[model samples]
Target: MEPPVPSKPQFSLPVDSDHKATQFRLFSLSPPHMLAFHLAWLSLFSNFFSTFSIPPLLSLIRSDLHLSSSDIGRAGIASFAGSIFSRLAMGPACDLFGPRVASATLSLLTSPVVLSVSLIQSPLSFILVRFLIGFSLANFVANQFWMSSMFSSNVVGLANGFAAGWANVGSGVTQLVMPLIYSLLTNSFQIPTSTAWRAAFVVPAVFQAVTAILVLIYGQDLPDGNYSKKSKRSSSTGSGKNFFTVLFTGLKNYRGWILGLTYGYCFGVELTMDNIVAGYFYDRFGVNLESAGALAASFGLANVASRPGGGVVSDKMGRRFGMRGRLWGLWVVQTVAGLLCVLLGRVETLWGSVVVMCCFSVFVQAASGLTFGVVPFVSKRSLGVISGMTGSGGTVGAVVTQLLLFSGSNQFSTQTSISLMGLMMIVCTLTLGLIYFPKWGGMFCGPSVEPISEEEEEDYFLLE
Candidate 1:
């Protein structure tokens, strides 16, 4: 018998058209693609917005609830610990059960916890609720695996970029809008400030619940490729042994660890900055809550705008150079931005600090887009595992960064402490670029780039 031939992949849009014509075609075809894009974007939005909401409200929660810095740190730890645990579960579950079920279920589950945040009175209770929210919010990873697997390799960057960019908008939106929303609702309804924050949570929670329900209704499931139903059954039944086997196999691949470490550094710096920036501003310049929240949103705005642009540029640049170049470029940009944090004192005026912070946010977000953009190209079959491991690294980094921020407790001189932390970020960037980049580049280097499977090819076309 002859060997079976693999079918050629089809793109919804032609890959080889003239630049102008391609743009025109993409614009024309965008309506349908936009539907999927927006659906995915909403998932991203829900995940990020929910993730960022608590930071802006931290001071209020601390003072009103009489919580300590360590207490707040524990809350952060609880949230990320939940995220870590959920990611571990979702990675394998996503591969086994499919993205649609995993994503919609998790997103739906998270809504109640988000709504409950405003009602928590004690630090322990708050931490516990946040942990639940984190666990249920594993939809972020599920969504990433789905979108990446659904899009074509040629434009996977763009799809991921769009989702990442828009999703980040949630954080910016939360930062920019939450304080205002809280203020307005508090004054308008004569609600207590705590009640206002709870009310603030309602908007995103409702939005997420509705979005998740819609996704469940309309979201297409990606087909299982090489893994068969029989194999899945056997693996599940033997998962105790399979778990160790997969773990050992994955660990043997140095590339995964290198990528995980690189991701960890970026994740750590980004999370640390995201969690601490409002407090950093408040401590450094005595900025009010609203102003600090707005400034923190700047990172999201910059991230959202730059991510799609990064994808387009990466597409033009080719995977190896594009991915590698962005990695190195982000390293430089992050280093400069970290150094720029030292200038927080030199800024003197609140507006000056805001401007610098916004610029800093832009670089951080661009780095985020670039880091995630490399995931699809690393390994097609193991995308879930790669994402899980690297994502976990990033989460761990975040936990570490938060711990560092919490430790720097000279309440009167937080600016100096933040500046020192910024210096550490500079070190992290340098280490990532010089030590890790070359190692990762070598491990992922190869010519046998596994083609996107037929079902995903179909999904990408439907998306377009």
Candidate 2:
């Protein structure tokens, strides 16, 4: 059955103006904004749900496929490897075709892969399919890119965080719920054990397919319409070559690299955790499938509050402290996450380890929120490429961190790996603290921004 429709939307004054603005509650969204926001998270939820689907079932898949722990680690790499390049491509696609088309297209393409997990019979086939399935992970770029397009810089951080946090809530949701679905299908319905795990993928596939159709029907590329239509009204309208040119131009900026790499520590850790957390519990505590999945879910569950809280913090920081507030929040969260990871590595008890990990999750996810808080403000001209590259950093971090630690090890000993990554986070945090732009004047200087009036959609990004 289809979902119920929401109440009618109420419009408000636009996001940017030189005048004092009226305030509303966070996420008190109306028609078009509300529609775009929900649809973005729906697509992201389905995408990551598919991306991490195998992790919750990792123990079962390992036993069924006769795979080893090292094999699983390699499979994690395969999953992240598929995302990095695809994300780079998907970002520009969002810019050229519009986020609606990019998001729906990727989701529809991935639904089949979600279903195909059942067919793998060997280690090679497992990695191949896992890599192919990773393509769906790029849908997040579309999600945030779409949110960045719809909202103004003033609250884009919060909008980005809420959309991302809720969307990401699916990871925890999948880990929490998928096993129960598998058990029900296997035991109550008398489906074969092997068959039930495969059939479990059907839920996410069907959900993704239906979501694609909904987005196409209702979601908008811009606040008004598609790129072509909006370009006619934009001061900066152009052809396909112009879009790439603008995208590459944005890529040339170093601020994106710093944000992207710092993001690598935050979201990179999130992706790595989603892939390995269940396995960590299974191996460390000798827990059952349900307990391990729930324990691992603690890492992602923090997103429900952590990511939104990060956005609100960044927004409020910007309000009081200007651009430095966003950077300061980013620096502090990363520092906290690093310190927590260091502590997490030292914890020997089960609940103690879980608690440390959950605290680590909050700061890591919060840092991700703060990273994007700086993203829209980086280069509005090249927001698509900037977002894409920044998004790519997460996969890069996952691939590099995993390959460095688990590449040849037969077993997944997470403590040393955790400590190593924590050290890396501290280094990145220090670099963030030292970063400065002389043109902007000082370590904490605000951007020299031009005032933008409401109704004009294109000028929200200032070169200052």
Task: Using lDDT, give the best candidate's number.
Answer: 2
Show the lowest summed lDDT stretch of 10 residues, model 1.
17-26
Q: Write the per-residue lDDT of candidate 1 for residues 1-464, one digit (tens) a residue.
A: 99999875444544332111122122333322334456667776877787778888888788878888778778877777777767766766665566667777888888888988778888789889877876754665666676675565667666666676777678778888778878888888889876777778887778778888877776654422323453566677874224444444444545556556655555556666667778777766788999888878776677667766656555555455644555565566556667776665356677887787776666655555555666666555456666676677666766665666554443535556556656766776554443222222422342233446667644432221
- C-alpha displacement of 401 in model 2, angstroms? 0.7
Worst 10 residues of 2 by lDDT: 16-25
- Tens-place lDDT per residue, model 2, 139-199, is 8898889888777767888888988998888888889888998999988999998889988
Alpha carbon lDDT of each predicted model: 0.64, 0.80
TM-score per candidate:
0.79, 0.90
